[model samples]
Target chain A: MDNNTFHHALKIREDLCIGCSHCMNVCPTEAIRVKNGKSVLIAEKCIDCGECFRVCPVSAIIIDHDDFNRIFDYKYRVALIPSVFTGQFPDEISEKQIHSVMMELGFTHIYEVENGVEILVDAINKYAEQNPVQRPLISSFCPAVIRLIQVKFPSLVDNIIRVKPPLDISAGFIIREFAGSGIPAEEVGIFYVTPCAAKIAAIKDPVGESSSSISGVINMDFLFSKVLRQVKQKKSDTCAIPTSGELTARATCWSLTNGEASQLSGRCLAIDEIHNVIEFLEKIENEELNDIDYLELRACDESCAGGVLTTSNRFLTADRLRNRATNRDKAPVQKHPEGFRDISSEKQFLEDNISIDPIKPRSILMLDENMAEAMKKMDRVNRIMMLLPMVDCGICGAPSCQALAQDIVQNNAKIHQCIFIQKILEQKGEMSLEEGVSVMQDIWGFSKTNKYRDLKGI
Target chain B: MMHFEFPIEGGNFLKAGSASSQLKKILKQLNVDPRIIKRVVVAAYEAEVNVVAHAYRGIIMIDIDTSRICIQLVDEGPGIPDIGRAMQMGFSTASPEVREMGFGAGMGLPNIKSNSDELSITSEVGKGTTVKITNYLEQ
Candidate 1:
């Protein structure tokens, strides 16, 4: 009944989807509905968090991004590299070398999203100190988590820090550097080489902002091969690599869990992965985290390094990141005025508009669109639920006992669809399926003329 | 009107707050207002967690109508010795283990108090405790 205005970053190839309901069970938004043994995505409800993308056994979900050939559309292509990109490779290879590799891949300039993180972090620290409103101020870096708050935890929307993701800030930097210097914005294409599909969705249809400054998104999995090849091509070219001053390990470690929050001082709650994040959000909603100063919620296991698009194991990437940061000779951050000063002073954050249009409930329990009818069906469902054993074993095609109850009320299934109920009925052997259903209808006092009567035969 | 009841076992951290989650789900299915649902669920969760943390065994009864929701939690455990003092912030009687787990900062009753339209707690020191929380469906 609703049309989704936001761009969905992940698309499912319906032909490949097995309708196994794995994605449906795990979806935070309940965006996926399996009808007719095929997965159907309700676009309006989808946050494009890619939890479905990660869980799909058949890889039916594909992340939407610009093709590699799209880079040729602009005269000068600039790639915004996330800090997690550096941790994907060996610790010995510096981030500067990675920049050079991107240059080799025809990127004229490679700006670090970490630069944006540095500025954003400093700005957030200052903002928290200045405006002591609530207990735990939520971090807005992870687009998935932000949208999760919009969809599920609307009460905490005001708690989210009014800040843009690192990529948006980095794109702003690129626009300032090149656009004013007689370079048209169209001529300079700023692409994000991201480790997660959420970033792709963020660029296309950003939350809490009007339009993203970043031109396109290129998943890190796609660029890993090109970067790996370029790294091997000119292994000895040290001059092209930028200095350590430009690339600090502190900024680069944003890929790991709590990497950004560790830079900030105070009680910070960093939760990673969708399930863990959901759990923590429940606690936050419970007001159990009043003492916590900051809440960092990432939708990936080990943070962005464990993103669906990443090739390396998140644990390895995390270790590599720590080793790289510890071995660095320079200070954690440079004292240069250009980087921190611009970030801390100006504080480039978009206006907070996390209030997405209220989404309609994707209720699996609804038996009818009419309220009175739905309530009557709900009562019947509850009655049926009481009759069956509550084991949520999915042998009946429905996800759980509760789901089967809704199905029964909706006339999509019969009371005997539950294996436990079926087993009991089989053991009794006195009544046929139709008789059993009729008995149930009589016991529940449901009308014989109603839709539940149809399931009497089936 | 819809009524649901769920049992709660003390010290079962794993299953704590599940009843509240189920209640939230039911409210969503009924298409309750999002704001009202949040207020009711938060209050219910705090009451639910209190039972899990302090009570030996408890039963949560949720009664919903077109106009309001009433969550009544009755627990058989060590009842609060002093209800007046317990309402004060940061006065926690939780064990070291529960405190270490980042719970029992004595914010449970207060959280429920703030989120709900009406909250009443009645406890008998040696007997048990009963918490009744009610929230209107609309402002």
Candidate 2:
């Protein structure tokens, strides 16, 4: 019944969705139900993997970022870095130097997500020992994956290792680490530099997890560029600029292509491309992949590196990261604050949030009549979908043939929206060029987001 | 007047998660709260799905009353030989196909057990399986 509490991290513009069923099709939990005319993203089941936003070429999907000005109201500000970020920079930018950059960025202190990952790994490793020889343990690294499993594969909810994501785990530690710092948790703002929409959505809709400790999110695209510009303009190029071999890069790397999950033991496999991940998760539902010990699935290919709104290119950025991570000697060599206190209670820690709640399902699915009507609509969709190839050519805003079907039922779309279908018809002398142009304009609706668009108006 | 049953086939990847969704729908019509409904549906669905994934074939029985909701999943599929061990968190017999859909977390039984106010399982290896779950109202 809590499915009624479905809250979306991002809202879909019916005008922008283009009836593309990509989001619905790739959602891990099957939480997305295409009803009416547009995509109905079930917030209860959405893992916030940001897969939909990434898959949408129209740049229609977006995660709202926090205004840095809002932090000025706070007495103190801090930046939380994921451990995977340790691999994002050059050797000159040592860990301590990166901390200095926080000072450079008007933040009083900086915390590493790696510290959280280490502690979280310890907790999970402890849990694994108690339940060895059971089912292969799944990594809890991905909050989206964890929640996706929770709502969609509640049957396997127990299978989800009782651990939290690096960010949540780390943020909790920071609070605890700052307990006696003379700064109140409320007075101090700890902003996370997010790589993808999942973390932002996770902040809003946490699953198989605990309350978020993050105060707010700053997209790396926004934060990194400003920091880089500030550093460049400072004329402090040769000052060593407080080098950081940790964070900013390796943490980004950790989120790369399921690298962090590979660190865990079990029948594990990683899936990129939300659709593939969804299909894989479904198999897990049907009792397939039982022997595979660990599954490290990411909605985006190259995992977090392929995050929708990052400033870096997937291939080039990952290559640069590889260079940085190789030089770092791992933690222990990394520096820590001289005097820091944690501000969180053990009861409030992310690790303590593994308990599952059972309630009566208050799902407001299609009423009997609604279902019948939906079924009829679905049949029409099916017929149209069959006529179109499944390639999801994206000639239509919809990613695949099925999305066109969903759009058709919603009445917001038509079968003629598909260019491939039109092309097929044209070859068969069923469509004319003029008709194709009209369908093209109708399929991929134009957005005024020319500011965010690339050369091709993506 | 109000009953729903989905024929669950063993090893059917595409068919998996069907019963859970159906049961969820039925519970929804009962005017259950969204939070409670999600929990019940997810738990009941997990158990039902396990029947299809881990067991051979099974019947999922659910009864919703004014006081409480009860679900009994009886399967002809091979029963769990070690109920104690199987009950542990992260234990699973799911196949690769199930894992692909992210259902082989081995957390199924533990989730069902933890979520429900009352749960009982009786099974015999190679014989069959049965799982009973009761979620009392306001409990």
- Candidate achieving the largest DockQ: 1
Task: For each candidate in turn, give its C-alpha RMSD to the true structure in angstroms.
Answer: 7.4, 10.1
> How well does candidate 1 match the true structure in TM-score terms?
0.78
Residue A39 accuracy (lDDT) in model 2: 63
lDDT at B15, model 2: 73
TM, chain A, every candidate: 0.78, 0.69
Give stretches of model 1 more than 4 Å off: A1-6, A15-38, A42-47, A51-58, A91-97, A233-239, A243-245, A331-381, A387-398, A403-458, B8-18, B45-58, B75-112, B120-130
CA lDDT of each prediction against the hidden true structure: 0.74, 0.62
Note the clash tally of each candidate. Answer: 0, 95
Best by TM-score: 1
Best by lDDT: 1
* Model 1: how far residue A22 lies from native, Å: 5.0
Q: Calculate each model's fnat, 2 decimals.
A: 0.21, 0.07
